[model samples]
Target: MSYDLLFTGGRVLDPGSGRDAVLDVAVSGGRIAAVAAGLPREAAREVVDVAGRLVTPGLVDLHTHVHPGATYWGIEPDPVAWCSGVTTWVDAGSAGAYALPALRRAIGGYQVRVPVLLNISAVGLTGRTGESRDLAHCDTDLAVATVAAHRDLVVGIKARIDAETVGPHGLEPLRRALAVARACELPLMVHIGAAPPTVGELLPLLRAGDVVTHCASGIALGRGGLDPALRRAYDAGVLFDLGHGSGGFAFDVLEAQLAAGMPPHTVSTDLHGRSLHGPVFDLPTTMAKLLAAGLTLAQVVAAATVAPARALALAAGTGTLAEGVPADLAVFAVEPGPFPVADVHGRRRTAPLRLRNEATYLAGRLLPPRLPAPPPPWIPLTAAQRTALAARDRRIRDLLTTPLVTPDDLADQFPRPPDR
Candidate 1:
């Protein structure tokens, strides 16, 4: 049988099936047709040699904000997603009921896979403190209705259940989000940082199939250094995701968790306007950091691929390179290096190995890499750009503080489809 494309001579490492060997992969239409050594070259219309490179299933980032032009925290996904070889990106609660219709409209145009986690709040993250800050916004019924309305786009519910996002409401927002998730019959992904309810308070409320993101953010969960609370949650089947945002990942906290025999169930980049710049450039960078922190390449690949695919409850063929699956895959050249890796706190570590994305195939087709965006404009400026604009410029302040976008901003972008 003739194949649409062929990838030959690559180290195919698919942790999902314990596939780690040099193999040739053939694609027919958009699904993988075969995976073995030495397929006849004449059988494929196009063949690419990938000797010495690592071939992985298309990556899935469980946390990101790609509602660009619609939310203040948003960014264009194609440029970043293509550059990083990520085929799927989950926008973690960037838009709620009022804004979801527009967010969905924006996502439909992108070629990438964007499964969203509906925000439990009515207004979502487009507010000063966040949607959960005011309990009035945590309309469980509204969120339930919204999820029901957009069941195709929304896979789960997201709630930033920290002191900063939800304020003194503590665990109240989490509980409400849980209710909405239950009502919608979807999983709940909770973002935990410094918390008033504490990690202890959050875990027991979460049942199996729920997720706790930012597991290594040096929050109350990591203060005591990887204890029973985390272990119990893991035992309860609560997935831990690395929501490595601008401030969510801390090496010390992660090391402690690792020492206690715990690692992230899935890896994700909380990519947005702020994090896409530095410290959290992309998912590979996040995965490389963990590789530097002692996770084997296989472990890192599993977290980024198969594990996240399962966590999101994606369709049957979502995260594997097995035959009959979508031919979504990535190629990376693992470079030996003393690469400088930094966490959110500006602390740095030198990694002995780094994974560099060389090329990617999206559903049996290769795409040209778009030029990467320059480092955040403010990063390279002089003292004047720093001090002169420090007090007056809204853009500078927004970049530095990384505040949540206001509801008015989203309303302007996705204006509620004129009443009937």
Candidate 2:
């Protein structure tokens, strides 16, 4: 059978399949047809030459907030996905039982796949914080029923356990979230921040396959070192995710984890409205932070792809380029770098390599590039960032305002009558 599209001469680095070689990837019927060393160019309808580019499964960002215009943290993933090569954008707890339907409706409008980690709080981040301050919002029965109703969309459960979010409730909110996760038999992804219920109390409650996002949080980790309890959780198979939101990741804390031989199981941008512009720009930038932290390129790729897919037990072939999988693919230019990358605090690190997206495709259809909307009024920005944004707006205005061509460049259609 003839293939629909072929990507020739790319370094097909599919960590899920353990295949990393200069090869060709063919797609047909919106599914991967083959991944072989060579294929007849004549058999495919269109062949894209991707020489010297790195090709892999479209990235799966395990933690993000994509229910825009509804949740305060939400940002539209499409504008970011096309340019970043992230096809699976997991909306981590932007909606809870009360708000799940709205989140579900929001995702339908997107081109890329968006699986949700249903928020434990019924309010679901509609505001900036306090999603779980009231235990009533953390109703296990409601959350379980919501999961049962939308198993197709809900991948896991999410709870942000922190001082501001939980208030005086402490670990009660988390206990309720765990109850929902247990009832559904789905993994739980908990976001950790400041105290009332510290990581010490929080880590022991989580079971295997459950994710602890913001694993390197300085505020949560206290003294900025690997606590024994955190180590125990890691040993007991609790997965760590670098949920690099506005205040989540800290360089020193991550460095300590690395020193202790504990690496994050997955790297994610937690790319909400607050973190979208600065600190956490996209998944690739977040991945580069791990590169700066000393994880090998292959290791980072696995954490971003197969590990997260397995962490959530996502659909079959979700992170693999195996034949019959939906042809979700990405192509990137491996830019060598002494590139400067920063963490939430003003700390900096130089990365050795950076992957920049050239193209992203989902179900064998190329994602169109889309410009991002201006930052919302409440999103905090540095003065320089504000100035840069204004300058960019001016540039776009200037380009569009200018005439397309001079009068002399145009040809007359009715030259015989000297058309006006």
Best by lDDT: 2
Question: Please, what is the whole-model Cα lDDT of each candidate in the order they appear?
Answer: 0.84, 0.92
lDDT for each residue of candidate 2 in 1-420, tens digit (9 for 90 to 100): 799999999999999998999999999999999999888899999999999999989999999999878879889999999999999999999998888888888889999899999999999999999988888888899999999999999999999999999999999989999998999999999999988788899999999999999999888995566889989999999999999999999999999998998999999989999999888999999999999989999999999898899999999988789999999999999999999999998799999999999999999999997778998898889998899989988998898799989999999877686578
**Per-residue lDDT of 1-420 in model 1, one digit per residue for the tens?**
999898999999998777999999999999999999999899999998999998999898999988765565677788776667798899999898889999998898877888999888878766434667789988888888888889999999998877778877888888899999888788999988776768888888998989999888875566555757889998889999989987789888888888888888998999877787666989999998898788988999999999988998987667789889888899889899889898888777777788788887788877565544333443334464346445445655567687568766665656678787
Candidate 1: segments with Cα more than 4 A from true spot: 220-223, 371-420
TM-score of each: 0.87, 0.96
Distance from true location, Cα of 140 in model 2, Å: 1.0
Error of 2 at 88 (Å): 0.4
For model 1, give the 10-residue run with minimal summed lDDT: 372-381
